[model samples]
Target: MSAALPHAPARALNNLVTQGWNQLARVYNSPVLQRVAYQPPQDEIIEQLRIAGIRRIADVGCGTGILASRIQQELAPDLIYGCDASVGMLRQAQARSDQVRWINRQAENLGLDDGAVDAVVSTHAFHFFDHAPALTEFHRILSPGGLLAIVLNNPRSRFARLLQPTMVQGLAYFPPPDEMRTLVEAAGFRITEQRPVRRPIPDQLVPDILTVARRG
Candidate 1:
């Protein structure tokens, strides 16, 4: 189990995450970052979404709406909601396209009705969330059998593990595959698939794990 943060530390961590992302919002979509961090797992995420036959979807921690925009163009989901806590990030996302409904909200309180979406996709953003509450919220907003895809950094190397704690200062947590499966299942979801995202270059230092689940 992941260690629980005391109230003060948790609040501080939340502020740090929000502030840091807000600062990065402008340059977050730059090509360099996209190539290294964002683009690689996109195809797989979209494929999973397609396989799930999603019509209405929510992109939690959507960040600049890159994936959401792609889904809008490719899958052409009936409704697309892009949600993020950072106003700056949401602003950038809003600029991408008017088609997506941009909502300024955190993952734990998405402000959507119960069972409101067919699928929820969050990439490279789950680490910054309060996992248990966020997972519970994800389950709450998803319909029975609703699909969920989460892409996040799950460091495995000794070097990566050593650095992980100091890097995010308790603001982010990357649970390994076994722990992640437990967390997801505990939230009332059945694990459908779990795999490592193939990156352009090998990235053993900080690998991305994709976990897909269906609400039971």
Candidate 2:
């Protein structure tokens, strides 16, 4: 029997994710979708930024620039870079604010200088990344002791768990909180906080989890 190709599934999933997001970019910020999928975790991320008092930050996988625009408006960070792999997404983001320097880049290859930002925030985006290299990139781009906040779907309900495999077909793999913490630590970050975001819609089965770490 031929040995299984371990990386093939991951590579295929990455391709699907990239294509799906590019196709979804036009309608991604539609009000109904935003309300259900984007707003809650976004609010949580902003709160995290407030507590951290980050002066310079990068919003990785910043689709449509909603969170980055909000950060620019609310926190008034000294510098804000919105980075994403999809040109379609970056195009939408550019229209949100000229203040944000939007760049077309993957999470694993941000093309930024070392220690370029004080904080890196990625909301609802981590599951789509190549975890290890992406975390390595986050570490490379962060100043020493810089904060990294990642918000992602962490299903706890039986209904959600049952649907996870189907979702992974289109959405890519989402690591559970413990696995995520291990991955972050292995990438040289010190875990500071890992908690579930209060679900805005109580019936929402796939809730978001926030994992905050600091570069050592």
Candidate 3:
């Protein structure tokens, strides 16, 4: 049986997202897309984990496992699980890393054990998820005191803010930083750090929002 009318919107949104990403899976990490898509601050993520002493990382919405590969190389986490909804993306990810566990899974329904991941990281992908269910899953899989860091496109950005609707076919949204912090808190997290990346206001800035929280 399908979901009721109230839940239908979310279901439709998920379907659209899945379809859109699946179609783009092959070219998602291509040079053309890379120039257009805003990327998370990889060096910053590594530095933060170094400071926090985090291991056993889970990279949600890990498109082609690019960031996951970096983490495996830099931090060499004991367990790095990379999950994405697109099968094509997962196939490419598997081709890249034999160490990282590449799973074909959605954000809201991660196939991971409870308290399995020490830190959950979603980079430039949270805006594409069903917030409530995905956040709940993040809370569920993370250990007590585990960190949650999400990177998203800054809605204030000239490019992302204005051109997202034309670029992506599905229901896409970039919430304000404050609203995001509240959502994470509602999912049983305590906000630790929330800041803007590529700040100092660059001329052609790909502004991003990074929010770090802890499960308590």
Candidate 4:
């Protein structure tokens, strides 16, 4: 259940990287995170590898490297890359014990070799991006039949509707699950599945969708 909490107070940034991290990394430490985010259980990641056969993953919009840190611990993909436009968030992701590789990049320009990753995963960060450019990057990075899973915060939920007036209007473009499938397909992804999960995020009505898609 998403609790729909408002964004938090400002963070102190020592550099541009810190400034970028402030834009989204705040979620990692926010007390409000409990409701809106569904951190995939470690077990599901293992299963994703077995079920979907993902080898390497590029986590776009990887704020604070929270999920990547855990993915490094659990899946330890042959290679894992966390990409974000925020230098601050990249710094935070890189600072996490040096195991995670952080990239100071945007969703539109991955700067990676074509077909470099087996999968791309994002958590609650897509709404900030220009969808067409970001999806183009997703297609560019994936090998044929590669997977893309984006877990976005759902605004249709009670908490999101209540909090929308303040959380940011950009989210209006990111609709609920079925509609999202239509978007994904329009972006050239063959959606394989759409699974919903309930996460406990304080002050939000939280229902998350882990949309599974494959490159044509």
Candidate 5:
């Protein structure tokens, strides 16, 4: 089991994550930053969604609506919604497209009906989430057999370890692969896929983790 973070440090981390993401809302979608951030496993995720006959999907932690917009165009889902905790981020997303239903909300408290979506995709933002609660919320919001795909920084990587201090300083966290899987499974998901991919950061390459599961 993972060691629990101290209350003070945990709160500090949450604050930093909230502030940093809100601050990054302005530059998040820039081509430079996009290249640095981990990209989602789009092909695999799309294939899974297609196989499951998904009609409605939500992008939690949908920054600037980039992934949500792409899913809208590519998958052509009937309803594509985007939610984020930061108003600044939501503003950017809302500005990008009118087709997506943009909601300013936390991952743990998504103001949506139970089983309202067929799938939920979150990219490069898991480190900032309150894992247990967010996963529970994901399970609650998803239809039976609904999919959950998360793309996050891989803390197991050498590069990521070197970057941990900075991230921790910012009040974010990168959970180990096993820990993340456990949390998801404990939240009532059945893991289907988990792996890592190398993504280019500004000055170096960093590993990104991908995990896909189904609400069971």
Candidate 6:
């Protein structure tokens, strides 16, 4: 005779994972589901830079350096720096040789020289910068014509709704894409491109949006 998994037992296990991600997302300033959706917003960043001819990058608020590592492998940025507010997450990020320089600092106020980097990117960390001085810092570090890619999760989806009061209601979310474009353009970036990076899960039917742009 063979044994099959009990229905409730499976559900309980699933709940543990759901709860873990939920709690993580709660503490997380960025979107957990969106970050994991499609190899995260970092991969999209590298592809855009490849198109734009950027050779260096700075990943502000780079949680665990998920995107930083991808950029290092794809393009071999001569100068790559990963800065974040959380020392704990910064420590856990993949670090090997001179591939990346990880610094524990706030993104809005990067203390780097003017036009220090070729591009600046972040995945799902845009809304976390309402009062943080990092937006100007992004402009300070980026060279003229450098690419700036910011990926945020679009909460307008059925799965986000089903989660109901939890995700949509709890997070300190900002307004829609027009507002994001307005803010970035006001920060001196030309706002080159914007679109959704949709990653579909079979059971959960919400798609994440990965927004990309440039720094003029």
Instruction: Report the lDDT of model 3 for residue 142.
Output: 96
Error of 3 at 20 (Å): 2.4
lDDT string, candidate 4, 8-70, tens digits? 222222133335456756456564453234454223444565577676888887777777777
Please write out the lDDT profile of model 2 over residues 102-154, one tens digit for every residue. 87777888889999999999998888888999999999999999999999877
- Tens-digit lDDT string for candidate 5 (40-105): 345446666778778899988887788887778787889998887766677777778788888767
Q: Write the per-residue lDDT of candidate 6 for residues 91-151, one digit (tens) a residue.
A: 5453433477776555756667899998888875554554235668888898887777877
Clash pairs of candidate 2? none
**TM-score-best of 4 and 5:** 5
Candidate 1 lDDT by residue in tens digits, 1-216: 002211222244677787788799988988988988898777788998897788999999898899999999999999999888777677788878889888877798888999999899999888888899999999999989999999987766553666566356887777888999999999999999998898887767448899999999
Q: What do the candidate models score in CA lDDT, each in turn?
A: 0.84, 0.84, 0.78, 0.67, 0.76, 0.63
Candidate 6 error regions (>4 Å): 1-40, 94-98, 159-171, 198-206
lDDT of 3 by residue, 59-82 (tens): 998878888888898888889998
The CA lDDT at 118 in model 2 is 93
For candidate 6, the per-residue lDDT at 203 reads 25
Least well predicted 10-residue stretch by lDDT in candidate 5: 1-10
Error of 1 at 132 (Å): 0.7
Residue-level lDDT for 81 in candidate 2: 94
List candidate 4 stretches off by more than 4 Å.
1-27, 30-38, 41-46, 166-172, 198-204
In model 4, how many backbone clashes occur? 19
By TM-score, how accurate is candidate 3? 0.85
The number of clashing residue pairs in model 5 is 1
The true-versus-predicted C-alpha distance at residue 10 of model 5, in Å, is 14
For all predicted structures, in order, the TM-scores are 0.90, 0.88, 0.85, 0.78, 0.85, 0.73
